[model samples]
Target chain A: GQQVMQIPQYQHVQEGEDFTTYCNSSTTLSNIQWYKQRPGGHPVFLIQLVKSGEVKKQKRLTFQFGEAKKNSSLHITATQTTDVGTYFCAGIMIYNQGGKLIFGQGTELSVKP
Target chain B: EAGVAQSPRYKIIEKRQSVAFWCNPISGHATLYWYQQILGQGPKLLIQFQNNGVVDDSQLPKDRFSAERLKGVDSTLKIQPAKLEDSAVYLCASSFQTGMAAFFGQGTRLTVV
Candidate 1:
């Protein structure tokens, strides 16, 4: 079975600080997607990476996919209160029978002003 | 465009009771998914539907849970004889295809006493 694991289950940072979360998979993945869930809100898609060793950036956020396609990372620079939420990484198994995603535990980000 | 839609934003029931949640995916989407998110945990895929047909349900507790997406559109998830451990948020998501990114609904929060 394929499994995705994330580190730093919870994180608290002051406004203007930086934060990062890492994700690893037990098996190689065809692609990876990132999502964010606000407090009391549903998960929202942020971005997706397919090419190996790819890196994408959106504003102050940076996402990177490992060369092996079995790991990924999300980094937030100068975090803000609006950045408070859980960040999840979902990996699509290369040979996924159902083409379903396997989600990591997620990193809960809490920012304080 | 409208995202996925789910009903009963919140629910509370005692053990042994039965509850059902409904979901309507975005129009033109061909893949739908049901996930369970316990407090402080990431959403876990319970079932996957590829246009009204079950693609995978390996993680679903079929002994007490069941789901259906008739006509390859609207879907429903039912849980019978619920237990306290069943308290969680049920999220519905849909994507254009198995390999595409997904959009999620606000989710139905269920609390079994």
Candidate 2:
């Protein structure tokens, strides 16, 4: 069985503060994806990192994949009130048969104005 | 292109009742997944389908839960004699390929009393 663990299950910060959530997988992953779920809304795809030691950015957000492909992180800079939501990291493992996906317990982020 | 679609945005049923949720994935998508998400937690993988065939269902409760994707198009997940613990959001997602970003639909919120 594969497990993906995320840290800081809850986070609260004032506007313009920076926030980061870490994710670690018990097994190596073929790729890691990030998603966000707004309050009372569905999860939306954000970004995906494939190569080892890969780093990608989307505006104020930055995502990093570990060199071993066993961990990942998401950092949000200058958080805004509209950034309040749950951030989830999903790890995809490729097996000889197929690929299996697992999600980490999301980090709920709340930003106060 | 249309995203995943799920029916019955909300449901309320007493314990031991039966309920079913439907999902239609994006056109030409071959990978579909069903997940259970409890409050304050990330989505848990329940089952995965690859072109109307079961790929991974190890996490599904066979005794009370069942899902079917007929004609490699639409899918339906059914829960019979649901229990109080079944109160959660059932999400349907689809990806164009394995190990890729999954597009999720607005989940069906189930409240089992």
What DockQ does each listed candidate score?
Answer: 0.77, 0.86
> Which number leads on lDDT?
2
Quote the positional error of residue A22 for candidate 2 in Å: 0.1
Per-model TM-score of chain A alone? 0.96, 0.97
Which stretches of candidate 2 lie above 4 Å from their native place?
Answer: none
Candidate 1 chain B minimal-lDDT segment of 10 residues: B48-57
Which candidate achieves the best TM-score against the true structure?
2
lDDT of 1 by residue, A1-113 (tens): 77999999999999999999999999888899999999898889999999999999999999999999999999999999999999999988744356777789999999999
Model 2: per-residue Cα lDDT over B1-113, one tens digit each:
99899999999999999999999999999999999999999999999988988888889999999999999889999999899999999999999887888999999999999
Interface RMSD values for all candidates? 1.1, 0.8
